[model samples]
Target: MKSEPEYTPFELMAVAGARELKDGEIVAVGLGLPVVATFLAKRTHAPHITILFELGVVDPEPIHTGVGLADPRVWYRAKILSSFVDMLGMVLHRGLVDVGFLGGLETDAYGNLNTTLLGDPKGKFRHFVGSGGANDIASSARRTIIIIRHEARKLNEAVSFVTSPGYLRGYGERASAGLQGGPSRVITDKAVFGFDPESKRMRLESIHPGNTVEDVLANLSFQPIVPDAVSTTEPPTAEQVRLIREEIDPERVYAG
Candidate 1:
């Protein structure tokens, strides 16, 4: 019997991210791995997925991954190229977005993401680009999907600042604050997490192949609810590996 194709963690991550999106869903995608994942989905199972770039490029059939969100390469064959207002105000805030893809420097148990700072916000701290369109996307998109590296520092008990609201404190908190959508899934290189319906606390959904639940817990500072039986993340098919390497991200811009 022919053995299954070997795949890297990043390839597995891309496939995992692609699986979260459903066909015909409208996604507001961020940069890097999120872009690669979205493109992979569009090329494969979710061909009709509508992609919206924060900079106002809509449904772009990018020939290759762009250097940045503004790069012209990402806008190739775009159905609409407009301004931030059109994309964020007209489309996103209007509740047209089905899913929002995001990445961050830190995320807490409640799914609150912090892309703004590293240290104390009130005192000395390392500052990062606070939020481009992440806030709007997180708030209004029907549901949000976070893609980030699995590291102890990135997963915290509480982020330094709440750049993008998840559940705020917990369940019903978002509704009380008049927030719309909340975080649904978080995809990492080692595992997949989903929030509990009652407490809104993060819980382990699956562990990637070759990684155990212990491997995942060792990297997290806070405890995530682990079920008695956790599913293994399905590895990317040989075709998915080929599509990622040959068609989607040939230059290794994002997937690499």
Candidate 2:
């Protein structure tokens, strides 16, 4: 028998994100890690999952994993290459999507995301590719999963700007804004987080393998609520590792 290949941190993160998805759910997938995780989920467990790209590709089983959301390879064997307005406006806004998978530059305890600007939006600072369709997905999807790197700077007490609403000011604020759903989970290299019931603040649900709760705490700019019995995140199984390496990302494009 062939020995199982070692996985990287990114691979671990991807697997973690993939495990959150359930069978038959329609997922609005953005670029970067979200793409890899959604694809892996479909191939492994959620075979009936409908994946929608921001660029209007729906349920495409690409010949190969392309570089980003806009790549031509993503459209392979697509069920429908619909127009942008039809995908986002009709499908997403009409509450047809089950989950939105997104990535960002920074996130807060409230799960608010900031992907548009760095530092103060008022002053001189760097600007990223503005919310292509992340804002729409986050606002309209039934729930969302955020995948991002864990660090002090990335996990802040408050994001510089709310590119995508989470709980907003907390406890019904999101709902008051006419948004249907909000962020349900955040998967990082160090841990997995879910929102508290009453407070709507992020709670450390589990620490990743080889990482401690203290390590996760140290990296966050704000104090995340910790459960009394925090568990360790399940490590990727050999099958998951194999599929990610050999089938999902043979070229190591994103999973690497």
Candidate 3:
């Protein structure tokens, strides 16, 4: 059977995250982009990369299917199936996971994340679905990576709720909260961004293909500073583009 083509943007984001994985690393991946990246890494160079699903499965070889942890395939491919109690204990207390790949409802210049709620405090969106194990994922992983669609609405000046707990109050303060690793890189539709050492703010590192640095900056809600000589986001090589298009989401892929 032949696999369908990939839409450009999702492929880009998946490749962006997939390229970061190292063999033998275990990533606590969120849904969607996380799923694509993990599977892509598995098929390519990092077959040893272990992916820990929040639902408590590990290193599921998804074959050619696009389904995730919920897919029946996961049960067959997974090494273990356990309770949230055991998984939480392992994730938060045992110190086992290496990296966390999380998605955000929105992110701010400070890198604080909001994924569970939308509206606000007091009466707006009164009760919330709330954050998932993301709190633990952020607290335990050695490093964190965030994937989000780029836009003014999704990238705000300040987060509505610090649900996922970026550098609470500030960077070192996360250590005080017992959070091991806060967001290290935030990849988006238009560019790649990271936290500045001194200011603890996000700065533009690279722009995506077909988009100019000015275009990325213009779409952001607040000012995003560029380095003296900003670099372009590396395009996915022919290898990455092929796997993402073929095996990841063969039916149809999403674009930015």
Off by over 4 Å in 3: 1-7, 63-73, 126-129, 169-171, 253-256
Clashing pairs in 1: none
Candidate 1 residue-wise lDDT, 17-103, digit = tens? 999999999999988888888988999999999999988899887776678887899899999999899998899999999999999
lDDT of 3: 0.75
- Better model by lDDT: candidate 2 vs candidate 3: 2
lDDT of 3 by residue, 114-229 (tens): 87777766557744656677777877777788899998888877887887777765546667775666778888978888887756678888887789877887788877557888
What is the RMSD of candidate 3?
Answer: 3.8
In model 3, pairs of residues that clash are: none
Measured against the true structure, the TM-scores of the candidates, in listed sequence, are: 0.97, 0.95, 0.88
Regarding lDDT, does 1 or 3 come out ahead?
1
Model 2: per-residue Cα lDDT over 1-256, one tens digit each: 7654577889889989999999999999887778789988998889999999877888887768676767788788889987779889889988899999988999999998888999778988889877889899889999999998999999998898899989987888888898767999999999999999888999998888889888999998999999889998878888888887787778888877
Clash count, candidate 3 = 0
Better of 2 and 3 by TM-score: 2
List ranges where model 1 is wrong by over 4 Å: none
Pairwise TM-score winner, candidates 1 and 2: 1
User: Candidate 3: minimum summed lDDT over ten consecutive residues — where?
Assistant: 247-256
lDDT order of candidates, top first: 1, 2, 3
The prediction achieving the highest TM-score against the true structure is 1
